[model samples]
Every structure is written in C-alpha cells, then in structure tokens.
Target: MSLPPKTALITVGATAPFPALISASLAPAFLSTLSSLGYTHLLIQHGLTPTNFGGTPSGQSLLSSLTNLSTTSPLKITAFDFTPNLSSEIATSDLIISHAGSGSILEALRHVKRLVVVPNEDLMDNHQKELAGELEAQGYLIEGRVDNLPEAIKKAERATFKHFPRSGSEVFGRIVEEELGFEAEG
Candidate 1:
C-alpha cells in the first residue's frame, strides 16, 4: 500500500497590509504543477486580501477562485480568510509557504518545517525581504517571488533547514545587564 501525499500550508497574514503576491501568482497554473509534484492537500490562509486574482481579493472571491482552481487541479485546495487555530495549522502542515513576517518565520523554524517565504514587496519600507534573504542564505528557508513560485517549491524539496538557536528571557536579561547596565531582581 502507498502512503498518502504530504500537505502544504500557505499563509498570508491579515496584518501584513498587502496581498500575498506569491499565492496570487500560483493560482491559475502552478497549483496543478504542485499537485503533480505529490502534494495532496493545500490550505491557503488568504488573510484579508480583497480578491484572489491580481489585486487585493476579498475572501469570498478568493475562495471562489481557489474552488475553480481546485476543480482543474488534482490537489485538494482550501482557502480561508483566517484561522483562529493557526498553531494547529502550522503543526499539521508538512510544508509551509508564507509571507516573510517575523512571527511566521519563527514559528515555522521552531517547528523545523520546510518553509518558503514570499515577502510583500509592496509595503512601505518592508524589511521582510531582507529577513527572508538572510534566512535563505543560512539554508533555513527559500526566498521566492511571485513569478517563480514553482521553481521555489521544487527547490525547497531539497533545501536544508538549519536548526535555529532559541533565546529566552534569561539570555536577553544578561545581554541587557551587560549592554545597558540594567539588572533584574531574581
């Protein structure tokens, strides 16, 4: 008997202030390609994007588009505005495609999930690209673009994710004491 295919989660945060360009780019053609590459299910958290087309897509409209896309592709697709159980979603997914928000990056890294980051370059003074680039350089994630999402996904299958160091309050407190001469009472 053959095992089931892996699942992928793509999240574009509502607080991101811009649509997820990569997801938008993937809709018409690449979804089928992803399916052929062995992904069984794809869950897209569209956040507050107004439409799923080329611009800001409303959640309903995006879902409609995704539904249509799913009909044409073998991959089972689900698109939602947002999910309250984001941590649960993250934990369940085998691969993650996300906007380059710090929280998303950290969570995926913490879970050691295979990650692909598509930073929203539309935002004013967006630093997400830089962060994603740095992490990609360290082999922790793949930095992707709207125009080349399939290539990114193909590359991510073989990409290595390095273990990220965890920092805690005690470590931060020590740094503060040394750098700013501030001490916390134990």
Candidate 2:
C-alpha cells in the first residue's frame, strides 16, 4: 500500500525576500531528500520581492520557472506570494521550513509543527541567525543553512521538538513573569 501524502511548507516571510532559501528548498537534492522522507508536496511562500539573484531570475519569476525544472523525485511543488490564511497552511503541513524571522518561527511553533529554520545570512544586523540558533539550542526547531538543507531535513525527520506554549496560556504568563521577576498577587 502506498503511504499517505505528506506536505512540507516553506515560508520566506512577506517583507524581505529570501532567494537563497527558496532556491535551496527547491533544489534537486533537497526535493529528493524530502521524497525519501515521505513528503510528497512542497508549498512555498516566496515573499514579495521582484529582485533577481546574482543575475539569475528570482522571486515570482523563479517560482514560475519551477514547472520546467526536472527532478527525479516526484515532489509536487507550488508557491504563492502572500496570504492571510498561512495558519491554515501550517496546520495542514507535516513539516515546515522557514526563514528565521520571529513571526514565522512563532507561527509554526504555535501550531506545534516540525520546523527547520534557515536564517537569511544576507540581511542587515544578522539577528535572524541569533534567533534560529537560540531556538535550535532550545530544541524547538532545527537550524539549517542554505547549503546544508539536505542534512537538516534528515535530522528533522527523526527529531522530536519541545511544545511551544500557546499565547495567553498560563504557562506562557508564568514563564514571562519568572523571567521578569514579577510576583503573582493572590
């Protein structure tokens, strides 16, 4: 019997476009890795930049070219620029690969999805790296680089993650209070 179809979602956020992450996620090696891991579909939120990457077409243009690209693996690929219903996509996905923006990270965590975070190294200040590193250190997600995504995918397949507390939950409140040294009043 065939295994049930599994979906992996990749989000690069809506403000700054991450061409490297998008390119890596769609690479033949990466798709093959996902296929071996039983993922049959790939959905990418490619963000809203029209810029090309080092003379190569990127952003919407790259996504348009995906149909002509050939891979040995039968991973179905699709992409969108932006959406208000990203939460629904996250809920349906068995795995998530995202740029290390805090909003994207938190959104995936809130859904308790298995996440692989790749911080865009080209961004100013490089804060995404710090956030991805901390989250990986905490066991909430796997931190991946553009060149090493295949390895990261292998790790994520066997990894178990810490449950992220829901917003406004008592656990979240307590953790915040403890961190801030605020005492609860009876």
Candidate 3:
C-alpha cells in the first residue's frame, strides 16, 4: 500500500508582503528538508503587490528565480499573489507554514492543520513575534524564524498540537451566561 501525498501550504497574508519568509521557505535546504519529510507539494501565497523598498525584489520575482532551481528535488512548487479561496487551500493541506498574522494563524488553526508560524521581525512594534511566542509556549503551534526554518520544520513534524477551539465556541457563551447570572435550561 502507498501512503497519501502530503502537501504543505505557505501563506504570507494579503496586506504586508513578507519577502524574507517567502525566500527562506524556497531555500534549497528548506525544500530538501520538506521533501525528506514527505511533503510532495508546496503552495505559496506570496502577496499581491511588490513592496516599495528600493531594490528589494517582489515575492513573485523571487519565486520566479528559484522556482526552476529545484529541479533536482521531488517537491512540486506552486505560488500565487492572493486568492479568495485560501481557506479551502488551508483545508486541503497537510502542513501550513504561515506569516504570523492573526487572521492567517486563526484560519489555519481553525482547520486543525499542522502549523509553523514565521513572524517577520521587520514589522513595526513586532507584535507578531509576541503572538507567535505565546502560541508556541501554549503548545498550539510552533514558532519559526526565517534563519532556522529547517530546524523548525523538523520540530513541528514530531510535535503534537493542542486543539484550538473553533469559532462560535461555547466557552465564551458559557462565560457570558455565568456573568449574567443566567440559569441553565436543564
């Protein structure tokens, strides 16, 4: 019997482009690591517009340069700017490597996918780092750095995650009822 193909999805969100995370994810070493771990496909959401930094290449251009460079590896690489159906993409993937945006993180977790979050350190105030760190500490996900993605990938492969409650959870409703001194119907 043959095992099913494993697919990993990487999303950089739609607002700010995270070129470093995109670059690191496509690095030869990282691709090799993913291939070794049985990830047969890699899908990247690289963001829509190029960043305004002088001389900094857009994620699409970076992807164009390296997309063909992995011919020796068995991983099939695909990339896009933005999509309205990202939730479906996340639902179909076996592993998710994401920028540390709350919306992206929550969406991945909502689908119960294995997640590795790489927070962009260049953002102002750097709250993404704090959020990723807290989630990692709580065992909900693995917090990864662009410089050490291969190590992070290995760790995430062996680590199990806690169940993230789905949206519209009863926990909040129960709290509200308690606060209002409402009695249970039973």
Candidate 4:
C-alpha cells in the first residue's frame, strides 16, 4: 500500500493563485525542493499578511495570527484543503514544516512530529531563527533557514525520531493533585 505523503508544515507565504508572487515566507526554492522530494502534504499555518506581500507584512493572516498565517497557500494549494473540515486536516498531519514562531514551533513539537523549521529573516524574524537554531541543537527540528534548506531536509529525513518529553503536562497534574489532595482509590 502507498504511504501517505510526508507532511511538511509551512507557516508562511501568500497564496492567491498568483504564481508570479514569490511567497512572502514560502521560499520558492524550499517548496520546489519538497515537491521534488515527493512529499505530498505541506501542512501550513496561515501567517500574517505582509504590509506588502511581495516585500512586507500587511495584516493578520487570521484573527489571532496564531490560528492562521497571512498566507493563502493552504487555500490555493488544493492539497491540504481537501475537505471543508480544518480540524481533520491538522489532525492527520505526519510531518511539519513552518516558521520558527514560538507558538508555531511549540505546537509541532508538542505533537512529537518531525519538524522542518523555516525562519524568515527579511521580516526580521531573527528570534524565530534563534529558536530554530536552539531546537536544532537539541535535535528537535530540521533546519531550513534561508541558506541551508537542502541539507537540512536530508538530515530531517534521516533524523533519529526521538519522542520529546511531555514534561509539563505530567508535572502539572501532579501539582494539581497534591493541591487538591485527592485520595487514592481503595
């Protein structure tokens, strides 16, 4: 049986059926490479609009910016938007490729999915790059920064899939239980 296409979460770019429009954060070369690599599902988080799509961020992609990226890649791609149900699309993701926004990165890792983090420098998303770099150091994500996407994808493909600890949730429950002083089941 054929396996599902490897997913790469992209949390940047503008999709309006405008091919000439270079992706704001979509990185054409990166997208092209993934396509060549035979990955089918490119999981994308809608990003904020550039003040200028070609060269700037204009508006919030979604009301919360976190819910969606200013990009329309998800809408126009015809790949992920297969159904009207957004939750199903996100829930079935196997891989994730996206910007280094803190929340965005956290969500990908929380699910323990392999990640390809692409940070945008043009918009001064330096913090995102720093976060990606740190995660790479910890072996949490594959790096696809402006300069080194090709090799990063290769490495991600071969990365040792280790489960990131869900440390907080487990710890939090313990604290709550202790505070509430629940009795043990007899």
Candidate 5:
C-alpha cells in the first residue's frame, strides 16, 4: 500500500459515563514510532470537542501535549481544539490513534485508515480497555499501554488492517442493533 510518509492520530473520550482512566499514556510512544518510521507529519489531539458537537480538559490536555510535542519534534504537528471536521482529517491521514470512543472510532473506520486505539481509562468505567482489546483481537485497532506502547505503535504503523471495510459495518451495525433492541446479523 502506498500510504503517506506521515500521519495524524486523534484520541477521543469514552461514551460510557464513568470517564476513562488516564492510566497509560500512549501518544508519546505513538509519535516516536511514527518518527522512527521516517514520517515527517504527525498530529495528535488528545481531548477534542463534543463528539457530534465540540472540548474538555482531557481533550485540552491531549491538544496541549500534541501541540507541545509538535513544537519540539522535527516534524510539524497539527492539533485540533476538538473534533474539527474529522472526515477530512482522517481521509488525508495515513494513521489515526484514538480512544474507544464510539464517535472517534467510527470516523476513523469510515476513512479506512489504520488506527491505534488507546482506551480511555479515566472517564469510562474500565470499558474502553475491553473495547480496545476486542478491536485488537478483530484486527481493527492497535491497543497498548505504557509497558509496550512503543512496540504497539510500531506494530500499528506496520500492520495492514485488511479488515478496514468490516470495521465500520460491524461496529455500526452492532451499535444500531443494540440501540434498537434487534439482533445484528453479520
């Protein structure tokens, strides 16, 4: 695949009310790996705005860190205050690192881009981790923690997500089925 030399990844908040835990940070590792891959472009916006709507502290923190790293790294990084027209963003990016948030994941999948999922443990109730794990299992996402974050990011960058097409259909179907109390027939 003739992917881009650089990429941008974004992590969003969880949907489940509890708030994801900010336990293990994965952005740095992600960025470093991209750098190692000879990527000249990388952007990470941590806390973005309201999902379908606009920004929170975590979102702010993510933005801050992304911007900070961009300023320091040799590459130029672009950080969004919140969700800034993600369709366009991901379509142009080669990779995206996002939380298990429904909105974020869906957007990435829509673009058929590779994604590294770092579940939000701060706001959510330990659900994102499971979600991330499941995605990893399904070959739709690359989930990691501080322990092997670097390795995970590298894996993500190198991974060829053949299941890109299924990502959106499955996830979207499940969400709709669950909401409508209907069994999703995949």
Candidate 6:
C-alpha cells in the first residue's frame, strides 16, 4: 500500500498582508523546491496587512495572482486570505512555513509540526526576527529572510527539532496583571 503524500502549510500574518509577495516573489522558487522534495500539497493563508494589501483592489489582484500560481506548480496549491479555524489547518499539515508572528509560531509548535518561519521584514518594530532567531537557536524551527526561503526550507527538512514546551498561560496572565499593578480584591 502507498502512503499519503506530504503537505505543507504557509501563512503570512493578517497584520501585514503580503499575498503578493509570497505569490509573486517567493512561491515560484520555494514551491518548486518543495515539489522536488516530494511535497504534494501546499496551503497558504495570506492575512490582511493594511499597509500592503488591505482595503484596496490590490488585495484581490494579489489573491488572483496566487490562484493563478496554483495552476502552474507541480504541487497542488491552495491560497487564501484568511481562515477562522487556523488550529484545524495547522493540525492537518505535515510541515508549516509561516510568518514569524508569535501566534502562528505558537500554534505550529503546539502541534509539533516541522516548521520554517519566514519573517516579514517590512513592518515597523517587527519582533518576528528576534523571536524566530531565538526559536531557531533552540532547535525548534528554521528562520530565514523571504529572499532565501527555498534554502531555508531545505535546511529545516534536514535539521533536528526538539519538542516545544507547553506554555503556562496562568503564570503569563499573572505576570501581566502584576506589571499593570492590578490589585487582588479581597
């Protein structure tokens, strides 16, 4: 019996929509590499980035460009602007390539998926580079600039990644409360 093909999920956070960047600038080289590496399915979630693609016809045009790209790649590609159930999408993927947004990174780690983070470098005070750098140092994921995505993905596939530790939200919340000087009501 034959095993099912491998799948990859890619996301560019909604805070800075760059569907066009991924579709036009990044996908061709990256997708071609994945296809050569035996990935059969590719899914991309392009979020709403106000500066680049939000509230304009350019966003639709970018989406159109992605759909057009899907037809030509060797891998079966599905690209979209957003999804309400991101966890479900993460659960279904074998590999994840995403923006270095903390939310997306945590979700992918929680699922223990092999991950490659491509930090969007255009936003002001973007903390993604720092976060991705820290995670990569710990053997958790691979990080790269968009210009070098194909090579990054290749490195991630061969590298060893340790399991991510479960987070303590209650402790985190308490820290936030303390920082805000919230007094407990007796």
Ranking by lDDT: 2, 3, 1, 6, 5, 4
Model 2 lDDT per residue over 45-121, tens place: 88864434532233435734576553444888887888899989999999999998777887888999999999899
TM-score of candidate 4 to 2 decimals: 0.57
Give every collision pair in model 6. 16-49, 17-49
**Per-residue accuracy of model 5 over 43-150 as CA lDDT, tens digit each:** 545453432221322354444544556567756776444464667777888777676666777778777788877665565356667666766777777886545656
Go through the candidates in order and give each one's C-alpha lDDT. Answer: 0.73, 0.80, 0.80, 0.52, 0.59, 0.72
The number of clashing residue pairs in each candidate reads 7, 0, 0, 18, 15, 2
Model 4 residue 19 distance off true place after TM-score fit, in angstroms: 14
Candidate 1 shows a clash count of: 7
Listed per candidate, the RMSD to the true structure in angstroms reads: 5.3, 4.3, 6.2, 10.2, 6.2, 5.4
lDDT string, candidate 4, 1-186, tens digits: 875566655544332222112243345555566666667655544434432333313343323332333253332232221234433444566666666555556666677776777766654425556656666776777867545665677677789765667883553344334434565455
lDDT value, candidate 4, whole model: 0.52
In model 6, the number of clashes is 2
Residue pairs in candidate 1 whose N, alpha carbon or C atoms collide under 3 angstroms: 49-57, 50-56, 50-57, 50-58, 51-56, 51-57, 51-58
Best by TM-score: 2
The candidate, 5 or 6, that scores higher on lDDT is 6
Off by over 4 Å in 2: 51-61, 70-73, 167-186
- Report the candidate with higher lDDT, 2 versus 6: 2
State the lDDT of candidate 1 residue by residue for 7-121, as single tens digits: 8988887686445563554455567557767888888787776654555233445556666666677778777778788878889998898898877877787777889898888
Which pairs of residues collide in model 3? none
lDDT of 6 by residue, 1-186 (tens): 855889888888667765434643334677788887888888767666433453222344555655666677778877667898988999999888888777788789889998998777776656667667767877888997777878887898898898876762443344334444587557
Candidate 1 — which residues are off by over 4 angstroms? 20-26, 51-60, 168-186
Worst 10 residues of 6 by lDDT: 49-58
